[model samples]
Target: MQYHYEFILATMAVLGILFLFTFFKTVLPIRRNRMFRWLLVAESVTLIFNVLSTWYNSSFGQVPLIVINTFDVLFFIGFVSRDFLFYCYIESLVQERAPAIRLPRFLVWTVVEVSLLLILTSPWSGIVYSINDSGYHIGRFYRLVLYTNAYSYLLFSIGIVLAAISRNVLARIERFSLIGACLILVVGNIMRMLYPTYLLMDSFYMISILVMYLSFQNPDLYIERKTGLLNQSAALSILQEFGKRETFSVFALVLDDFSENRRLYGVRQMDAGLRIIADYLRTRYPDCFIAYLEEGRFMLIARQVLPVTTMCRDFDRRLQEPWHDIHVSLYLTASYVAFCGPLQVERPDIFLNYVATALRRAEEENQLVVIDEQERQRADHDAKIRAAVDWAITNNTVEVYYQPLYGTKEQRIIGAEALSRIVDPELGMISPGEFIQVAERSGSITQLGEQVFEKVCAFLAHQDAVALGIEKINVNLSPIQCRDERMPERLLAIAGNHHIDLSRFKLEITESALADRNVLQNNMKRLQEQHAVFSLDDFGTGYSNLMRVLRFPFSDVKLDMSFVQAYFSRHNRLLPAIIDGFQSFGVQVTAEGVETREMARELTRLGCSILQGYYFSKPLPEKEFLAYVARTQHDPEHTIRF
Candidate 1:
């Protein structure tokens, strides 16, 4: 008995030293987790009592059983309190909130503490111990005390398990850490039950230390590096767990132009901007978790309904506030989708996808749009458009239609622009704006553009090319095709094989196609060397101001339809300035979308030499365009007013 007492004292002393070391070591890293800190303090107190109990039992010949039982009850109380604190710590981690140490609200904590106090003070306290016949004190109610201890530990274990499952606080790695801790506790409890020894239970303390160590090992365990919020990887894990037990609504606010801003401001400045937004959100919604999904986008999940709406409005307002010394306007758009009731979303990825789709639709409409049933219908329409585009690629469904370009002075057919026309025999004709982007995204535009160019070249080789006195045929180049290095060589080879003059073919490239200046310059130089005239199509639509016109090697420039639409409006000053700027560069100007005879006369007064618009004809098929050109050749002064 004396030897057992000495061993227990020595073991308690070792545990006390280890606990102190762990407590000091964890304080700095986990200082924010007040609940965890309190748990460590409670654990230290429990170890101190165990040490005192061991000393009293060993020093005195007839030590009071009540004193030993009192220490046992206090130790058990400490264990339960620490276990509850562990659950609170997990809840804090998952919520990405700093844990606050608050007095227990439920009757459970009061009942346990009060029961412990009563058990320690009662006369029956000695029931846990008895004086043996050989003048030695021994634990008598070992089975009963063990059962009570097991029940108390079981309550703590169940609380932690419930917290873990309900809160979804643990990541995959954290979950494994938790499972390891539970395993150690289970093994320690089993050993205590079988051997009736306290030493075996102390072995599990090492596992708790390991669990703490593991928790701190993850660099982004608490905060994200990118946005200074909880990362998506962590937030998604928490959301997944939160979905299981409770009914909460989720709303996402995405920032627009995050990447462009990042590029403009540099990485450090962008991160600082993100941190500012994150901190603002954290201060406003203490319960909500924010994450940076991409450089220019953030995902915020909140429980409160009205607060989320208010939060989104606030976020947009803050984003719109101009950054110091930055000339760019802070244009931000946010789209939100809420999930409630029985339709619970377990996967964050799917929820995020829906949010992204809603955001894209909102941006397309260029307004603050809410995702409703109509938006879902729009999404369905988009999906069908995508499918149609895919079908067009596989089945070679896209066709090329010719529209004649007549000389204003000659009134005869000069050339034609080969326009892309997708004729779906089953679904009929789809809009160019609808499937053209899809074709570009799917990399089918390269193939489609080449096909159209080949067809235009083939038509020029036939007898129809000679009948109309076609001097040149204009073929519009897709931006994707313009990027291809082989495009100039391919066009030249096709012209040479057909015995067609390269000088007779005009290649129309949009202003958007000149985004990559180096690629554009190289391709333009190569094609220009082959005597193929280059025209800047839809010239003024993009960032093509007068300065761009001076830089680009264009033989002809087509003014955009928007400029022509407002030609006679109050903004008429810009049209003359644009034409003067192009004429100064010795570039022949073509006015697109000239509908009325008044608009055409105004354009001619503005010194626009070439005209192409509905006043002459809408885009016509090959035969109709040829006939229209023949009729126009006989009558140069014919005025068809729209």
Candidate 2:
């Protein structure tokens, strides 16, 4: 019996040393997680108590069973305390963000209250010990103590299950480790309960320590090193498995200016920005499966059909929001395609390919474009448009049409916006929207814009006498065309060569052009210095932020047709506010696409200086536009009708 005590002491001492080393190693890396550190402290205390109990039993003469039972109670308390710490550690691990200190407080207090109640009742009060003449003593309440120990182990086992369900990825892995420890505790307690005299069951506690050592040794097994939202490989495997199940909607959000950001800010700062974005996405869309797809791009998978438009808009807003001593300008676009058909259970790689195709199409169009089978067919249509664009560039198939901008009070044409018309001869006239996009994509817009500018300058020069009555001739500029460093100089040179006054020429830039503030500012400054006026065209069409409008230098602001159309609607308050806002900036306002007397009346009431639309006259060829201008000038009282 004495030899059994000595063996137990030696075994526990060795196990305690190993457990201490493992705890120190694991805790070093995760020192920031205060709960995990506390767990190690609790574990160390329990191991110390185990060693103390073994030593107290072996060194002393045959002690009373009651004294041994007191040590047994202390051992049980230590076990319970250690198990509670394990639960806390597991919960902390899975969260990975911040540990909930209150939860462990509640749990520990509850356990202490229960233990105090059992102690006050003194369940083993009268049956302290049974000593025979042989001096070998045994406690009468041994079975009751064994039952209490078993109950404690059962509580810990339930805790493991609870922790498993409550945690995130990191917490779940820690829960797994806790579950392993709990199982060993349960088995050891059960073995001791069945055979009270058995000291061999102490080996199971050593096994639990060994399991903890294995769990703590590998950092990769526990915490995600990058983005700190589970690692990419782990997420990919899970996503692959999930794809094998029911249908899900996958979204691939590609940040357009990620490379620009990387160049502007170093790689380290870029990574930090990505992590912040990841954390925001994870918190907001908890159910959505998200991962870093590549540099400046992320992939999201959802069990439900996510509102892609709303999500994309919200995400863009969030990324652009001011953060920590830095205000980032995020140029983000997201494209998503839902899977509900036979391809529901397709491989993740294949699904990702389809998503990539959709993203590419969206980026090409610079809009949130979806790629269904119908959209795929449009790709073929787009190819035809591309061919037309190619012909237009080489053969000068793009015809220049002029739209007259008439002054309501003056009853005369003040300017004309140069519009492009594509006549394929074979396919006839193509829609401007359809072909212009292709031209922009094919890099033909730079040449196309120059051609249009040259023609307008020449037409102005030839009609200088007749056009002197007109204040300015406005030529629309594509956002892509504005980026070219040579565009302003080239346009000024062409006007100078044609002997046309640059003051008589106004270049109309879209609201979208304001998105690139640096380019817009530089071009506007250079053009203004050349005595050319700048006008904001299609103002309310794309991302009409009031702040951006205030920043731009504009001689005129063209209120888009959508706002003009809405002027007659019940919510007409916005129209006046928009007009007043631009006018307040000392910018002249032009109401575009005015098709009704009511719209014209509304604009006139709001003090709109210039008006253009079907109400005046449709965009006409050069010869027809001249004739229309002549007729309008001659007949002041003629009410134009389409």
Candidate 3:
């Protein structure tokens, strides 16, 4: 019974290189990767023990009986353990993709326990192998153990194929690689049994592992090359594995206004700064899972409570100094949002969205926020609102409500302001302010605006505004809507579809819409060409610049309700002067929030041509608004008294 060692040594060399690559490249502590690494260890150990056992058996006359027994027993244990580890690796891979498909743990462990017990008792009972003074010999149950091992491989291959067929989440190449590994092991065992003198099993194992590595385990998929931190995919993989059951803390550091920074500092310099930040975090928290989420954002995850305050302080302090070698003093502001808990969402994507919302909120409020129950509720609510918005727009459930605007000179309802309203069956009347903000943030504002505009067109076409003494209907536009290059054409097409005149459409825009003056000006000019009118709404809110207002062709400027309320309640002198200046520029001043007749009289005296508030009418559905206009036209005292 002579054994060849050349093929065995060659296989060991290849496996050694493969094991090192797998060990060093696998940075994420994800369950699947960990299982695969353990499988590699088992393979390496089994190969070494097999080589030792082979050498000792060749020198059976010279080597001690105890050493031969020890090496052979260890080799068998390692051999059996390799199959189990491969099974675990496959199970973890499937679980990561489709967590529902779990194999029977009790059945697997039962088989493993029995196999290990038989191997452990083999030296005394000689059930698996025997070492007589003549030579090493296979015992009675050796063939049975080999059959069982081959059966397990066949079972694993079947399981992998079944799981792959049932779940589309597993990649095709991954499924094939896994199934191929099992089949390769089984075939290698059969071939070794046919040719007892040839050492082929270890070589086959090496080939199977190489197949897996080439298919999916490439380090570049998960590592961010520039920053040397795990990339977004790696972060997501770790989160998906532990998000539902594990309690951990996640700290997100997002660059404030990342787009602006990218534009200002250039992409290369910003990337250099990101690398510096990554290095700082990686050095400070060596044990934590650090991921560079790109766009000047990094995520730090830890299983235990972290010194968040100390870490943030040190992070900020380190960032104050200019990036080394880059030499440019890049001042990057970072928003911090931290939370420690089991993510309640069912999927990793939802959890990521919730974290992103928290980060954006932190950036907007300019504060470090620890996400608590209230913040979680807010995130959930925003998610629901986003869903509701999508459903409403998709189902055409978005309704338009009109609030009448009163003409001071005529003392009649001259126009109305179109507002969007969403009434969820469960949530019931979501606030316009809240839903609008959610829609804008979720990038659904343009679609929502289109839906509302189309509905308004339908209302204007069906209802006779001239018959009701209505001159125009004001529709509010968000900054995001105005930035769209096709918004003007979309609005005109909607109005044309309904055979409505564009002149009767006074598109109201908030001061924030002035952020991109060129886009707004271009859209405004295109709309005005078709006889549409423009009005600056929310005049006294953020970034209120009168000179910026004059950049577009604005027919009207509505004083924000805040300014109107301040003027009427606290005698805000600035409001009156601002109104006078806009009026003098030949822009009709429409005072919003004129809730009382006294306030209306004062605003009219202050030369405001149009007054809109609850004093005239709260925003009403199409039927109610039309009826109110008709009633006011017949009863002039209705406007003065009501």
Q: What TM-score would candidate 1 get against the native? A: 0.55
Write down the TM-score for model 2: 0.48
Runs of candidate 3 with Cα error greater than 4 angstroms are: 1-21, 36-94, 106-218, 223-232, 241-247, 254-276, 292-297, 315-335, 341-354, 357-368, 409-411, 486-493, 516-531, 569-572, 580-586, 640-642
The lDDT per prediction is 0.62, 0.64, 0.82
Best by TM-score: 3
What does candidate 3's lDDT look like per residue over 388-445, in tens digits?
9889988999999999998988878899999999999878999999899889877889
Q: Between 1 and 2, whose lDDT is larger? A: 2
Q: What is the C-alpha RMSD of each candidate to the true structure, in Å?
A: 12.0, 20.3, 6.5
How badly does each model clash, as a count of residue pairs?
A: 1, 3, 0
Provide the lDDT at 298 for model 3.
83
Global Cα lDDT for candidate 2: 0.64
Ranking by lDDT: 3, 2, 1
Ranking by TM-score: 3, 1, 2
Task: Write down the lDDT that model 1 would get.
Answer: 0.62
Best model per lDDT = 3
